[model samples]
Target: MLTKKKVIISIAVLVVLMTGVMLLGNQEGAAEAENKQVTIEAVNNKVYVMVQQVNFIEKAAEIEFKASLEASEEGIVSSKVGGKVVQILFEEGEYIHQGEPLVKLEEKEAGNNLRAAESQLSAAQASLTSAEVNLESEQGNFERLKVLFDHNGIAKVELEKAEIAVKVAKANVEALKANVLTAQVNVESLTDSLAYTTISAPISGMMDEKSVSLGQNVDSGTILGKVKNISPINAVIEVKQTNLEDIKVGQKAKVTIGEREPLVYEGTLKSINGSADPSSRVFKGKIQLDNPDQALKPGSFAKAEIVNDQKVEIATVPLAALAGNEDSCYVYVNDQGIARKRSVIIGETEENVVVIKSGVQKGESVICTNVTTLQDGDVIEVVAE
Candidate 1:
């Protein structure tokens, strides 16, 4: 009975030793696997990214906006007197100069009235000459009578009658002169009416419209056509209230027209409205461009870029570096091989680059690629261009 109890106790001891050895081996295996996993993670954790150094550059700020082209000078051709359109001297799209006759009207009636006025003036002038000769004779007789009275050779009553006769002759001459002046005025008035029979251009420009045809009788103040001076045209633009302060007259601007292949024109800021438009609530701006060829037509759509004279030093980065929308923009900057996401305030965008107003310093490396996949604190390997 003693031997059987000892054998059972030895068997229990061997089984406990084997279980301890197995537990030790499993623990060693788990430690080795954990160390290998840590080494793999340390080697493959870094991401490859492209970075650009932020640069400070001096550049003039530009404002871009939509614009509409218009002629600098526009004239409305109209008639001052009613008449029949005898001859049309200019056609639509014809170039004309100031004071150039554009339409001719029948001049028979106006010519006749002018001739009558001239005849009346001639008759009145001849009558005045005869009256002046008569007054001279009367004056000579008065002088002779005065001498006779002084020498007591004539009666006082006779001398008085001679003086009164001279005075009456002078009065008659003055009345005739008044008549001559009235006739001269009439002649001048009639001459102006005769000249009005021809309609002339008020300004130098191209005729853009025609309202009267030959043989068409038009009343006074009738619109004949429209003339527009297209050289040195105006490009009108609406400026927002926020950007009003940055622009002023005399600034340089570039105007572009067409979409497929744009035509660029150099211009200057001509005017800015003092008050905002009632409907758009924006200020109207005008840019003047020299169009010697008249290639810029009126009412054409255009785009304008106004460059400010004041230059500013600003930090810039590639547009690809921006990670968020316009309202919320961010960029990843490499800080000693570690990517740190930073929120940035952006300004104007020029081509593929953007102006960084804040949150990034000059000469700092900004991650341009793999921005979306980068976290707040990411291990990064900057690659060459």
Candidate 2:
């Protein structure tokens, strides 16, 4: 009975161990199947992309920069002479012409001085005339005395007195004539002072600012107002130092401002800075554009692009195909039905296309779409053109 009991217990232990081994094997198989499904899912995640066969374009190199439009002729119309403001002509913010009167100072005193100068001149002229008549009479008297003395009928003292009178009269005439000249100079000076009372615009523009009121006393160099010339306004561009080499004064450029069909304006490169800005490493440039209708305001933003004379035949690709920035730039090219990310040196852009300076060649297909989903060796299918 003991032996039979031992044989039943041993069979039950062996059966329990066999059941545990089979359960562990089934669990491992299920884990392996789950891992394999994940691998299959990864393999099925293919990105759909679009590509284009690019070619080289022969064109001149260009550089683009952004800046604002500044007034070409902006200055404060200051008081040239000090006086009380009498009349303020034209409204502030009104359009004024060159040399048009804007302000009138108190000129009553200047006018009175001018009249006084004129009276002094007239008195001098009368005195000069009387001196001349007296000189003529003295000469006649001296000649008569000389003739009488030659006949021994008059004393030599009378002739000497007549000669002295003639000398005194001539001296008086010269003095009066000098006084007339002095009076005339005073008249001219007073006339200029009176004219200075009427201050006019030195240039044609809108009155941008005013700093005076009627009946207010102002000193010389006081800013009465300002004129801003919008016609042929300045387009100021701050170009990067790297792009400053190709720009020159008098080169024609196109400027566009506003949005949704921006208005185009033709301009000439008016000036370029001699040195670069230390902080931004950019060179300032200026272009002058026409604004005949005065539609463009000062301080409006603008964009300027200048094309160099040198021509280059370089492979071009879409701007969207360039994945990185200027310093760390790259593009994706299709290599045997696979997307290969390539580091490229790029140049200027012409609208939607960009010139590939290096790392790309003519007749290569550039992957433009699905760029974000691509890897170095991502399988790609190019869309039909």
How many clashes in candidate 1?
0
Model 1 lowest lDDT segment of ten: 256-265
Model 1 lDDT per residue over 1-385, tens place: 8999999999999889999999999999999999999999987899999999998998887888999998889999998878888998998888899999999888898899999999999999999999999999999999999999999999999999989999999999999999999999999988988898998999998898789899999888999998899898999999999998889899999998986577889999999999998999999999999999878888999999999867878899999999988678999999998999999999656799998989998778899998888898888898763
What would the per-residue lDDT of candidate 2 be over residues 267-345, giving only the tens digit for each residue? Answer: 8999999988899887888899888988888878877877789887878888878787657788888988878899998
Q: Per-residue lDDT for 272 in model 1? A: 94
Give lDDT for model 2.
Answer: 0.85
lDDT of 2 at 19: 100
Clash counts for all predictions: 0, 0
